[model samples]
Target: MPQMAPLYWLYLFIFFLLTLLLFFMVNYFIKPFDNISSVSHDTKIIYKSWKL
Candidate 1:
């Protein structure tokens, strides 16, 4: 039977967790920008309509 070092497993787990954390962090940061852009677009449309 071959034995694997426990630290290798820990390293793999930490790497996977970091990857997941980074993905969610990027998603979280991107959502606010999308909302801000959409809100600004809506406001522009509203102002244009109001002017006409």
Candidate 2:
């Protein structure tokens, strides 16, 4: 029925959060962006300022 010290819990919580963040950064963002869109259609940009 005893409680923990405030600083102890705070430090542990912060450490756990930083560990989780590092795990995610090592998992997801360390890879290149994969091109999932397989569309081969042509895309054009027309200048509206030159149009009559």
Candidate 3:
């Protein structure tokens, strides 16, 4: 059991790292779409302001 401790810890660390990587990847992919939608909304607002 003592010999397995390090391997167990390593697995836990790797799992944590993988979770963080996936979280970042999800956020990274989502942000671009959010930004694009916001940009379009902003452009529409600007056009409306110009019309007013």
Candidate 4:
């Protein structure tokens, strides 16, 4: 089997780290929006109930 170079390993490691960082960043940013949307939905439901 052919062996990979050390530089290639380093590049792979950097790429993996970048992807992991992006994943966490997306999750972190998205959570607040999700909470906001859910809160708004709940308020809408409450408002609808009040109308009845």
Best by lDDT: 3
What stretches of model 2 exceed 4 Å from their correct place? 1-4, 30-52
Candidate 4 whole-model C-alpha lDDT, 0 to 1: 0.80
TM-score of candidate 2 to 2 decimals: 0.48
* Local distance difference test scores for all models: 0.79, 0.72, 0.84, 0.80
Which residue runs does candidate 4 get wrong by more than 4 Å?
1-4, 32-52
Q: How do the predictions measure up, each by TM-score?
A: 0.53, 0.48, 0.62, 0.55
Please provide, for model 2 over 8-29, each residue's C-alpha lDDT reduced to its tens digit, 9 standing for 90 to 100: 8899999999999999989786
Residue pairs in clash, model 2 = none
Candidate 1 at 12: error in angstroms?
0.1
* Alpha-carbon RMSD to native, per candidate: 5.3, 5.6, 4.4, 5.4
Number of residue pairs clashing in candidate 1, backbone atoms closer than 3 angstroms, sequence gap of 3 or more or interchain: 0
lDDT of 3 by residue, 1-52 (tens): 7999999999999999999999999987776666667867776644455664
Ranking by lDDT: 3, 4, 1, 2
lDDT of 1 by residue, 1-52 (tens): 2356677888999999999999999987776666767867876644455674
| Error at 15, model 4, angstroms | 0.1
Worst 10 residues of 4 by lDDT: 43-52
Q: Model 1 RMSD to the real structure?
A: 5.3
Off by over 4 Å in 3: 32-52
